[model samples]
Target chain A: MLTSAQLDKPIVDSDLQREIEHFLSYEAHLLDTNQLEAWDSLFTEDGMYWIPLEHGQEDPVGMVSIAYEDAILRDVRIRRLAERHAWSQQPPTISTHQVTNAIVTAHDPTAGTLTVRSRFQVVEWRKRNFLRHLAGGYVHDLIKIGEQWRIKLKRVDLVNCDGVHDNFELFV
Target chain B: MAEADPNWVERLVEPARVHKAVYTDQRVYDLEMERIFGQAWVFVGHESQVKEHGDCWSTMIGKEPVVMTRDSKGDIHVLYNRCPHKGAKLTAEGCTKHKPMFRCPYHAWMFRMDGSLVSVPHRHGYDGTSFDPDDPQFSMTPVARVENYRGFVFCSLSEEGPDLKTFLGGAITSMDNFVDRAPDGEIEVAGGVQRVMQRSNWKIFFENLNDTGHPIATHESSFLAARKTSKHKLGGEVPFQLHIIEGNGEAPEFWESLDLRAFDYGHSFMTAIFHAPKGKISEDYKAALDTAKGKEEADRIVSMNRHNTIIYPSCSPHTGFHQLRVIRPISINRTMVEIFTFNLKGTSEEYWQRTITYSNIVNSPSSTVMVDDVEVYERCQEGMESDGMDWISQHRGEGRDNLLDREIQSEGISEMPIRNQFRAWSHYMLGTPASIPTGGGDS
Candidate 1:
């Protein structure tokens, strides 16, 4: 459990901030290259990937969401992307995630937990001239395991999270 | 617009084959809006959506914007969203609690929740003019008919058609089972609505609701993914999340073993392939229902597990999961689906959470299972645009259907439901009186 004061305190260490920024950029590279399995490895065993359907939606269990996946569901999603019969991926979606404005919102070095917030815009295109622009804010909760950082929770708050969308085959 | 020849409908629809023009022609689509959607009973919203007095939820019936409101007396009404003054829309979108009355934003003209004109600013200026406040034209105009069956509200744009009950026909049992499974014999639309846009004809989505054959092929990617994950992690014992997705990969024999029933007015349903397995959630829910409605009634209610019940031209309700996917046709090539999850009144919080989970997994836009389904629908739409094929086949198990007095039942893999829908479609397109067949065993 994190205290309010701990969550509000920003990490002033420049080295830690650079490290977190590099980690996010690497994750974005994995997603853009469609290396979903490698991307999945960035999370802990019980990590969560959530996309709230409504703005400021607090609870995933009580409300519907664009996505709310634990490790098992994430595995299913990754596996589906590689299936030959996945008609939606017949012409696989190509996306370039531009992650910017990285900031270390909170850090508790003794607890091995750091919270980072960043803004991202993902431009995606697929066959049949289907193109979409997805812009959102990402809130990542990371925990240091030894010298390595693993994602505990990754929450995406899209500008149009609640708006009607076509198939969302790939991760944001 | 020139009048479409009556033969056009008959030429487009056959017993087991339909012309691609029925799906791709803009003229036919427009005629459908006037003939089919104009006369059929379309679902507006659930009564729970506007529970309190002065609560309003805006939705669409055909192309017309409609507002479902609850008056001060708690009576629900469905009125056109257009304000009588300057034709401005009453509400922008979504639900709002406008206590007492609704005020038009264009002018200060106010109207009761039931669409009765309340008052307008400077009313004396219109006393001698053509504007008459007493006339219904001066206020919001209500749809021809609005009816609620077990808290599910439906409205018809035309006044000459059959009532909601008659239009629902034998498919009303799905509604009964939905509410009856609730311990308190009711449900409320909880959790928020998830909307998805499909680049396909509305009827294509409707046909796929009872399409058991397509699941194995269309959803191979999703089911295979779930199977792989379950085998690797859970050691072959699939959990609830994977179970629903993997069920689509069932063999042809499994689909053939299930039952499919089609009724009048394009309504149909397929028996649930996956039952609520023996688990803590099922046990607790059953116990609650047993306590509320006695063991015998609870057993009966739980026994009627249905996968998707098509209300025809409006929505599909999954009674087993307490979710409704309402279909709103945007154009000949585009459609919008709004998914609403319902909470059974007396169930445990865990039980209601299952509804949310099922909806997010299977119905949400990002759902692995549904993305493939939407993809195929889009592919069908794209393929139909080509000039290569004139007719789409519906010949699977055509003559094998057992046509009873009231409903048509066939093998689970039959295309009887599609043919049955066209039967209603042709009837409506040709402007024939709808006569629901009566006399079948209530299975």
Candidate 2:
């Protein structure tokens, strides 16, 4: 009951799969390069970025998450990270992400929506701090709007989601 | 490091300042674990967490591992988590449900939910060996004292001390108000707990709870971000989420205008800086409260708005937001905080959702607001390692205390809460009871 979404695996053509892979890799590139505003534009207006505290947490409203951000919160975090007085970001965190294993989990041609699952490992570092290695899986629910793909939902599940953690200053 | 003199411990804290060693030294931290956490009433878990018989929740009181369990005949007990035989922890960490009895994984010794000996694996071998199952030492040993204050459970490691209510002193009103605000007059810990590991001393987090001076300087980035987001995104109308963040941006005069009250045993609370929010959700919650409780009583309950109520050395409860942060000191420079969000039993689902939202925004490790706070705490801890300074000031509003019956009242910006906490700290470390004034005027 607490597993990830149970969707039938659909065979997608090579071009569509390449496009999806490109979109995900571009998203990771934006994060790695600290292009937060560009990353913010990838989400639909009411889209959400969630990192559930518990594995297989179905309800964001009823259960707490490490992060369950809407557009406004994402903006607030981006703005804060850019602030000169953002002490936590003093020597801002730098990271590189490896996003692989892109698999198409679901497809809806009529609704122009697709679900892609991928695995990610991020090596994040800040000056005068320990280097953090974060491994998580991403579940992207994407929708096509006028030939552009926008994220409807991006769910990140860290391997150690339930463990005690230090400050997570940036979006995972 | 050399062993600290008893006289040095006495001199480390004064009426207006504390020595830097209190925050930086390993020896002092060892003493604190012994005197303060070992003797004081430490919060364990809420009764609601263990509602059914044979349900258990594992947690640590200071460094002592203990478990809270509900018995078959409907009783709550706090027992040491270690098995009596080979000293293995009886249960794994976190909560478990519907266990008929606690069975040791090592020797397979079984004990009842109330921690009485039920059976041992090799009965015939123990029969000739003078193994006394009836002896208390053979079973999972309970802690010295356990008390439940309106479903908030606490335990003391010492056999002698004030009872839980007496130790709580004037802080009981905040606890009372927490439950009374619930429409069903009952609240339960729900949602899941978020654990944040801090690279600073435990007292640094506790002191920041009532330290009215730091938010404006320490939280500038987050608050400014909130204000900027409000202006750009919502046409200057701050939503509830942004409002909580930008609230720290209130004028210093606004913070100074509120009231601060400090009790005897290191407990204190500041009056609400954010009033009962005016919105459709709040109005609906108020209406439910008015229905369950009388309108007048409900209004009274809502009027007792408070920011953070410090129960001293253990937990801080934000009654208005329905959140509790339990502090666990891991080492001299390491602390772990467990944040728990509560659900008012009879409130609408939207109201409960708001509680979860507040927890995510303000208390979670990923919170933009708390990131700055934690950063500042870490900076303070690191900066104190210098030999440059020897004392931390608690002298903001020293001589202006107005002594009430059992609490000391001061202006909002005063450091009286910190001073009052050290007063209790000195007493505990020096092996004396925290003396509370009996009458209204100064004694």
lDDT winner: 2
Residues B1-443, candidate 1: write the lDDT tens digits.
12466466668877899999888999889989998888899999999989898899998888889999999888999999998889999887788875668888888789999999999999788888998889998999999999999899999998887788888989999988988989987899988999999999999999999998899999899999999999998899898888889999999999999899999888999999877767999999999999999999999999998999999989999999989999999999999999999999999988988889899999998999999889889889989989998899999998888878778889999988898888888888986535434455432
Q: What tens-digit string does per-residue lDDT give for candidate 2 at B188-207? A: 99999999999999999989
TM-score of 2: 0.97
Q: Which residue pairs clash within candidate 2?
A: none
What is candidate 1's TM-score for chain A? 0.93
- Report clashes for each candidate as comma-separated counts: 0, 0
Candidate 2 residue B34 C-alpha distance from true site, Å: 1.4
Clash-forming residue pairs, model 1: none
- DockQ comparisons of all candidates to the true complex: 0.87, 0.88
Report, for every candidate in turn, its global Cα lDDT versus the true structure: 0.90, 0.91
Chain B TM-score list for all models: 0.96, 0.97
